[model samples]
Target: MSITLKLAWKSLLNRKTTALLTILTVAISVILLMGVERIRTQAKSSFANTISGTDLIVGGRSGQVNLLLYSVFRIGNATNNIDWKSFEEFSNHRSVDWAIPISLGDSHRGFRVMGTNHSYFEHYQYGQKQHLSLAKGEEFDGLFETVIGSDVAKSLGYDIGTEIIIAHGISDVGFSRHENTPFKVVGILAPTGTPVDKTVHVSLEAIEAIHVGWESGANLGNEPSKEQLLQMDFQPKQITAMLIGLKSKIQTFALQRQINTYKQEPLSAILPGVALHELWGMMSVAETALLIVSVFVVVAGLMGMLSSLLTSLQERRREMAILRAMGARPRHVFTLLVSEATVLTSIGIICGIGGMYAMLAIAAPIITANYGINIALSGITSHEWMLLGFVQLAGVIIGFFPALRAYRQSLSDGMTIRI
Candidate 1:
């Protein structure tokens, strides 16, 4: 090692406590900055790829965003339902390959209940065109049988054959319960790290069967017996939304136009990617706010690090005299000060990244459960590397003032020790 580097290392070791604290401060700031960026990137990935392998999302005429929200993410109620005839007609269209019907507006213990056919399990895709797989048991086969997502099973402690009651509405409390018409859990889907993880899937017939005794959202006459309910037809009159897969990519726009201009009922068909981009555009402001706050935190950390290095300069003035007496030029003293800062910052950056990985490893499950957002444990991106480069640049810039102070101290001391 060079003499200057050796001296710089010795000086940092002498103020071990202060140097360590400064490094830790920078490390924490890096953690927050990297965490925010990772979440933002992964959130966009998860939300955009929530449903793939489909050409378009078809729903009753409403805002494209709203239809995507209620149909794919199960976020809100549909303003209208497309009649079963309309769905069948579109499903049989020449340009369409497959269509999966979706029925919403019911809940089971705060988790949304989605009524769909076997086609959903067959055609729906997520996370890079990955199909849904059952973690346990098989798909629902009969009326009142249901398949649950991983989050639903984990949250409710449900297993195959476990019966759960459906709620009248999508609220956690105050919704009329579907006590008599309990559904048996037939399958549990593996976690996709998407909205699908929070849904309860049943047949469209099951949705109809449960609402048999209810009219206008309330039970009017006496409820039917189990025998009468079994004998009753279970055909759904309408559906909240439908996902259409086209036979040819070129037919997408043409099919979308056809759906939009359908004479039977007003309908909207949106490309999943386009709608996802629109949604992200609307949410970009909040994302920017988070990034700005994290940047400020990093700046504060750099300032704290600067303050600590500056405070240590007073005690090092005598050391500067000794170095000058040893034939070290003023630039040498300056280099020593700057090199020490560089070493501390390099270590801080390494520690910050390690700490971030540790934090993410521990917080992944909790985040998925609470927010339904997946934070992947992956390598740093080019953008993150650029962020680190900027941090190092800030360290070098912050070191400049301290290096200057040391340079002046060396010139003035001139072999005379200051008290």
Candidate 2:
């Protein structure tokens, strides 16, 4: 190593405690910045790809956000039910190609139960318009048959032929149980990293048949025997929402307008893409706030480095005088100060990146299970590379202030030790 760079290295070693702390500060700041960026991107990806290949989500008259919350995310109670006749009219509309009616209101354990026909397994899509695939068995084909999700199977220890009782309402507890008509787990869907992974699926007939004796949120009248239920045909009286795929992209808006202005009932039809955009729009402010906080943390870390360097200058004045006596120019002293910063920053960046990936590797499964958002340990994107570059550049620029102080000290204190 050159004399100046060698001197810079040994100098940091001399004040190892301060230097180590500064490096740690920088590393922590980097971790927070990278974490925020990763979660933000993954959240958007999960929400956008939650449901796809559907042109519109039709529901009882409600705001787009409300419909999206209950229909797509399964986050809240059912807003309102669309009449079965209304669903039929729209499902058979000239512009519609297929429809998947969603009947939600029951929960098994802590997970939701969704009721739909086989069209759901056939037409429903998620993540790049990928169709839902069965991990085991086949779709529900009978009144007492049901399908489950990967997470449900893993959490509840359910597999093919495992019987599960559906609850009356969405709560995990205190709801009426449909014990008389237990649904057999006939199918299990592969994980999709969406809300579907947390749901149990049953046929629409199953939904109606289970409610045969249910009235006013409680069991009423005599429950029919399983054989009697199987002998009867079931038709859903209402559905919470329906996902529609249009015959052509050009007809999406035309049908949406028609659905919104239906004469029989007030309804809302939302383009999933538009609702997703609006959802993100409402959430952007918080994202920006988090980004701002991350930026400030980085600034505080850099400021801490600057503070450490400035304090070290007082003790190094005599050292600078000796360097001048050894024929070292003022520029050499400046170069030494700046090189120390470059070394500390480069090492901190490396440490920060390594630590971030380690945390992600550990937390990936927990995040996927709880949030249904898959965290991919992919290589750093170009944007992150640029962010790191900016951090390094700022570190280098921070060196100039300390270097300037050292440069002046070397020139004026030449051969004259100051105590």
Question: Which candidate number has the best TM-score?
Answer: 1
Q: What lDDT does candidate 1 reach at residue 71?
A: 93
Worst 10 residues of 2 by lDDT: 410-419
Instruction: Please write out the lDDT profile of model 1 over residues 1-419, one tens digit for every residue.
Output: 98877988888888889989999999999999999999999889879778889899999899889999999999989989989999999999998899999999988888999999999999999878899999999999978799999999999899999998888888645447777777889899999999999999999998888787788778776777656787888778999999999899999999999889999999999998899899999999999999999999999998998888888887777778887887889899889888888888888999999999999999988888988889899999999999999999999889988899888764566555555
Give the distance in Å from residue 231's predicted Cα in candidate 1 to where it truly belongs.
Answer: 1.4
**Global lDDT scores for all candidate models:** 0.89, 0.89
User: Which parts of model 2 are misplaced by more than 4 Å?
Assistant: 1-3, 411-418
User: Which digits, one per residue and each the tens of the lDDT, describe model 2 over residues 1-419?
Assistant: 88777888898899899989999999999998898888889889989999999999999999998899899898886567999999999999988999999999999998999999878989999999999999999988878898999999998899999999889887655448887788899999998999999999998878888888878678876889888998998889999999999899999988989999999988999999999999999999999999999999999999999998888888888888888788888899889989999888888888889988999899989999998888889999999999899889888888989999988774566555546
TM-score of each: 0.97, 0.96
Each model's Cα RMSD: 1.5, 1.6
Model 2 earns a TM-score of 0.96
Error of 1 at 383 (Å): 1.8
